[model samples]
Target: MSRIPEIVFVTREEIIDELWNKGIESAFNSNIYAYTWYLDIVSPGWSALITDNYDYLFPLPTKKKYGINYIIQPLYCQQLGLYSSKHITPELVDTFIDNIPSKFKYVNINLNIHNKTDKHKSDTNSRVTYMLDLLNYDDQIFPKYKENTKRNILKAFAKNHTITTSLTPSEFISFYKYNGHIESPAKEIKIIKQLIECLIRQQKLTLLGCINQSNEIGSVALFAENNDTIYYLLGARNKRIKSSSLHFLLDYQIKNRSGLGKTLDFEGSMIPSIAHFFSGFGAKPCKYLNYTKNSIPASDLILRLKKELGL
Candidate 1:
């Protein structure tokens, strides 16, 4: 049995080895986004809250804006919250929320799917992601795909578009920059490049691409492996192409990885169209919460009073 939970805030540099060991060895929430090296690339200087027994961990990615400290969820980090090998009760979640340092006057963070609490309903917003269980063989899984998804896959095949895994980090970055519809800032793109390099070094990256008959790269995707799950970290495709290369690419992954007891996490889109695209592959929606709080009343009053007093 573990000791009574005593949560403590830890700085980024203070508990690196211990925290990462626990993260890999014991944490029940198996998300790559929570790992030390992954967090370092996307959310540098991030800290955490941990229980005395190291049974629970919560990453606090903070930022200071306009001289006020606040917590903001980092880019490419889909879900992060209480991670534990033990059962996470509502009360435990509340305890962690309550312990967030008061100096952070504002908070905006996303909790993992395993967490649930009624205590802070007013302060939380709902978010959804899609996940596909790949325990069944491809033949068994194919029947469950939406008809449209199947049609797209067939269409790509008929067009002679081939799936390829011979993509480099630099090639994928360039493709994404020019063809992707999403607005990725230069800094975020740079971080993505660095992350790809790191993942490649660890041999944990699955880079896939769809090539057209003309031998042009039309679509590309990057998936990161952590244990048995694969995260669909990022992807980009040419909109001008008539063929659905993304459909072909993801179907290729599902086919090869099926019956392997693995999961594919489509690191998500709340937009209906995008969500539908993911669901087409028979992926199901998983819900999580985003917590937000503002102690603006008290802080604003204090500021005004100080300003009026001229010191």
Candidate 2:
């Protein structure tokens, strides 16, 4: 809900390059900016996209820029499956908007507003992220945790298993295998390798791992660092180490990076179990904006019709 700082307004190319370099963990990067930003071009109108990602800032016509009450702005939200970072607050939003509409405006932020039944529940609120503050990852707090979670972590550590602090040949292989279960498998393994290669050469790669004696147990990769926060990119645990050791591993890493930030985000988890795991770490749930907009009324109607037709 807070406005992110260090707002850098850069061109689209720069944003992509920066994201590619830093491996920014955002779905909004490609869909919203790279693709949707072009909307203003094809369909010219007075619209502006403000973001705090520091990279994808579009320099729009300042003269044409008038922040209409969001209600009447006729602006659309992008519906990228990724979480949208919030750069504007009610205050900032107010600043952007100049002409105050005289009429009372009734707008709602209810998630799943358009969908009903199970369909809405599936992706009910697509714009929230779960952030874990590293300070929340304390050794003293671990003992007071759940019994099952506590037992597994200890079991894995006691298994005399191989745990590698840094991902090695074995860990890399396991990480990918585990990720295959996700709905959107990240770019092909080859692409990820290439991306990581580019990241490391540029020193943008922030990789961490935990292994049993020699067996790889858990690992995560991230980029971007300020004095107060660490943005998580990719993290996974070895099913073998499904033991609480993964918790210990992540906890160790969170503490390991406390210098860079007050907390470590496990990133947003769509699955309740995973979300619950992050919550167990005493992490705060954060809400960001995920938008989906359509063309003019006619065009938008057509799009909706197409969806129903498909059904």
Candidate 3:
């Protein structure tokens, strides 16, 4: 007979050491969001699940709304589910889902790219992110880009748009917000700004901007670095620029970071147009899973009301 792994809920105090230890051993756990300091700032009071030997782990970033406790995917954290040193099986995923404490009443979170599971009762939506392998230098990589992307890069160069890494986090945030890319509320923006500041302090932030010949900022992007991957966290561009300044900016970053053997992760939008834009850069699609469950009696009604109120 085979032994079934026992899953137990761990308090906050136990998280830092164990999670970091496990993360160090697992490539998938290398994300900065899974780190203690990052979580402390972005998702304080978070709980977790772990096996007896601490081989498998899951972080539950919970929040209480309207007196109902639920697990939420925190801002700036891309994926947080099922980090294990051992091979993860469908059975293990199902076990973890089944063992999630009933107190949460509701759950909605995105699993890591490595996670896979058998279909469950709750909704499971598919999400896609884009990634470009940076092993090749510009000489070899540029040809892989779509023709339209190439044209844009050439146009940007002809327009004398220069790429610079001088933008501060606050400046990048302001540009992103004013460009109408992020429609989040003031409170949410505050939280995101705090996260950005924390990442900046940790030396994990990369801010780049494209300046046109007239010395105006035409495009800006903020990348978060962790575990040999540069995540395209946020970006915005001035629509008035007929030149493809944004395209040139991204290409410059990819080329500049190429020899370092990092992957550029376009933490993406399932929205068709955005997906198309990422694809133009020769980025491949990486599909992940978003899991949700509502166990409360009136959970549907509550969710509906929240949506209607834009909460």
Candidate 4:
């Protein structure tokens, strides 16, 4: 009989070092969300589970509501789950899932793309992210773009729209909020702003905008890059010239960032319209899992009521 891998909850003091070491060992751990600095900004009191020697790890971004401790998917973070330096097997993933502490009564989080487990497959929800490999730049890239996307890009060019990276975070946020793209509460927006500032200070943020001859900002997007991927974090546009400005802005970004050999992650929307838009740029669908489990009494009932009420 084989011994079960002993998983231990890491203390606050140990998180930074472990996360840094794991990131250096595992490519997927390059995601900024899992880093201590980023977590400190968005999910302040986060912790993790780790096997001895840090071969396998899982970050648990927790919160307390009405005295009930639960895990949640943090804002601006797309995924958080098992991260490993070695090949992850079904048994390994299952072991990690089973070991999550029972103190967390409500758990809802998106696992990283590298994580897969048959143990709780049915309880997982699916979401698709779009990624474009930038190696096929210049000559080979634009040809892959959907015909409609090409047309829109040309239209923006014909209209003499200019692309610029001079927009500040505050300006972009103001534009995003005014365009009704920000539905988050003021507090959440404040957190997002702080995250943006931190990434900017690290020189990991790219802000792009499409402006007309009249100097009007038609569309803007914020792209944050880590070691492996350039994430299309957020975007907003003025309704007046929404037709081709966004298409042009995105194309310009891909073109400029191409040949760098990193993936462009369309940090996504499950909405059909948004998915279709991402597909137009030659990005393919990459699926990930979201897991949820409720252990608290009445939690399931409340969730059922919320679903019924469409809340």
The prediction achieving the highest TM-score against the true structure is 1
Compared with the true structure, what per-residue lDDT tens digits does model 1 show for residues 1-311?
A: 33349999998887666656565457777688888888888888888898766668888998775556789899889998888888887778888999999999889999999888779988999999999999675566788999999999999999899988888788888888787655666887888888998898868998999999889887999999888889999988787776788999999999989898899999877999999999999999999999999874676767866776777
- Model 2 lDDT, full chain set: 0.42
Residues 21-76 of candidate 4: C-alpha lDDT, one tens digit per residue:
55534754457677677777778888788877766678888887656789999888
lDDT (CA) per prediction: 0.85, 0.42, 0.81, 0.81
Q: Give each model a TM-score.
A: 0.92, 0.53, 0.89, 0.90
lDDT of 2 by residue, 1-311 (tens): 45433333233334454443232234223222123232333223323333454332322221111221222211122212212233323333333222222221222222211112232233234544566555434553454456665665667667764434456534563575574344434434444455456445545456666556655445444343323545564566555544455576665656566544355545566678878777665566665432222223465456756776774
Per-residue C-alpha lDDT of model 3 across residues 1-311, encoded as one tens digit per residue: 24658899976777657545556447454566777677776688888888876777887898876667899888878888888767777677778977889999889998888777885624788899998899776566788899999899999999899988888777777777777366566865776687788787878888899999999889998888987888997788886666688999999998899978899999876999999999999999998889999777776657866876789
Q: Write down the TM-score for model 3.
A: 0.89
- By TM-score rank, best first, the candidates go 1, 4, 3, 2
TM-score of 1: 0.92
Off by over 4 Å in 2: 1-126, 136-147, 168-174, 177-191, 201-204, 213-227, 239-242, 259-261, 296-311
Off by over 4 Å in 1: 1-4, 181-184, 297-311
CA lDDT for candidate 1: 0.85
